[model samples]
Target: MKKSLLMLNAILLLTAVSCKKSTEGGNTGIIKTDSSTTIVTDKNGKVDSLSESSTIVDVNGKKYEKTDFVYKATDGTLVKVIFKNDPKESTVAITSNKKTFTLPKVESKGGETVYKKDDMTARVKGDSLHLEQGNNIIELKRTKI
Candidate 1:
């Protein structure tokens, strides 16, 4: 009887220690990825912004500037846009629904930028992004830098 009581007491003590409440706070604001992307989140676990800025080197030892932006659709879909700019050429890549499409920069004026590939068009102005393919259009608001 004494042995069984001792065993029961040990089990209860272990359970109590394991279920002890934490005194620490919740997550901080920022999280960084291995690819140099930074994601900022609120205390409620909502994402605020994501940004990636890095330098890429080509085969000929030429360096190019690369920047990334993340946007959220009205229906909560996410799209990621990447821009690579060099003296000779510039391109924009958009990823949505697990598909990535790369487009060459067509025009930039008055704080608006446009990219085109085949019949698809993408436009960026201020904090919004507009994408058009055939008669279908998708609009997203900037969620990160």
Candidate 2:
């Protein structure tokens, strides 16, 4: 009887050990927040995080959303454009090569938005960015990243 009981216990122990849950490919080091923030890390302590916030601004007595766009020029230059629309006024900040230029919204009609500062004018239409400064015109394509 003792020998049979010992064999049964050994079999139960083996079954329990074999039925253990797997921890591979699970959310071991991922963090999320309510404000659309996500952080991912691996066992080696390398972390990658992204956070985006929803911003609403009132422009011309109407609500508009603040947005950002990144465009790449033909020469591989990157330009960052941030739009802040307020009920009273709208503006855009264009940054490239460590320089930033803030321009006021001069026109927004027919699916095209135009911002101007001094002799520089930027026009955004769909996924394309057109910049004009004096006699030079630079065209940029929108980047998804």
Candidate 3:
């Protein structure tokens, strides 16, 4: 009985130590496999893989709403966030050029998909979105709805 109790105690102690150590590890933000193209934010919320996939998440590491999508644009092309409020109204908002652009309109296409001669292409697959312009590419990964 004593031997068994000692073993149990040792196991419990080891488990507690391991758990504490694991939880104490650094909290690095999001990560991407394609280092050359993807860029994860310092808060681990947004990531751009540049290859063809990107991810976006909230401060809590939860993904943003809407499916992943990509867009290519020429240098100096200022992208404005437009709301597809019916086919006639869309608001424009200036955002940081993080390479990976987030879309507020989850279902807005604006009648066209590709922008010709823009030196940029937006690609969407599953929960990953990528935007490529010239040699610059941005990826955003969606973690939530």
Candidate 4:
């Protein structure tokens, strides 16, 4: 379980970096995720985090029930991810720079629903999500509305 979390955290970093590049011309990097809130860059290139009262995620075995993040991608596509608590699941459908990504029909890890591609793989567990693209991996938790 520790190893899995570590991988998830790594993927989170990758997602942060990818978002940064998509908007900032590939020169900035900011990574933040912990037991409470998840801070990520929005479509307008501003750092934002959801309210603690509205967003929740499990950390240290505690469940955090949160809402979805509704925002425009860098390419102007509407995107959002709904985070869950019990049973660990998430609903994510996003399109960036004319690229559409959605949930896959198969689950690659046990009962975990997988959304993947040739070089990218995302594993959703409740409110947490781990995405890997090539050597880049990112963990996304919490939701910002």
Q: What are the RMSDs of all candidates, in order?
A: 17.2, 22.2, 19.1, 16.7
Per-residue CA lDDT of model 4 for 1-145, tens digit only, reads: 4554455446557986875434446432332223365454444667645422334544555564554444433333333454344345544454333355654434546547776656778786544566678897666654443
lDDT of 1 by residue, 63-138 (tens): 5667667778887766668888878888989876557999999999987889999999989876688999999999
Compared with the true structure, the alpha-carbon lDDT of candidate 2 equals: 0.67
lDDT of 2 at 104: 93
Clash pairs of candidate 2? 58-86, 58-87, 59-86, 59-87, 60-87
| Top candidate (lDDT) | 1
Clashes of 4: 10
Off by over 4 Å in 2: 1-54, 57-64
What do the candidate models score in CA lDDT, each in turn? 0.70, 0.67, 0.37, 0.50
Worst 10 residues of 3 by lDDT: 77-86
Q: Which portions of model 3 miss their true places by more than 4 Å?
A: 1-85, 88-94, 97-117
Candidate 4, residue 39: the lDDT equals 52
User: Cα miss at 21, model 4 (Å)?
Assistant: 37
Counted clashes in each candidate structure: 2, 5, 23, 10
Write the candidate numbers in order of decreasing lDDT. 1, 2, 4, 3
Off by over 4 Å in 4: 1-79, 82-92, 96-99, 108-111
Candidate 3 whole-model C-alpha lDDT, 0 to 1? 0.37
Which residue pairs collide in model 1, if any?
49-144, 50-144
> TM-score rank, highest first?
1, 2, 4, 3
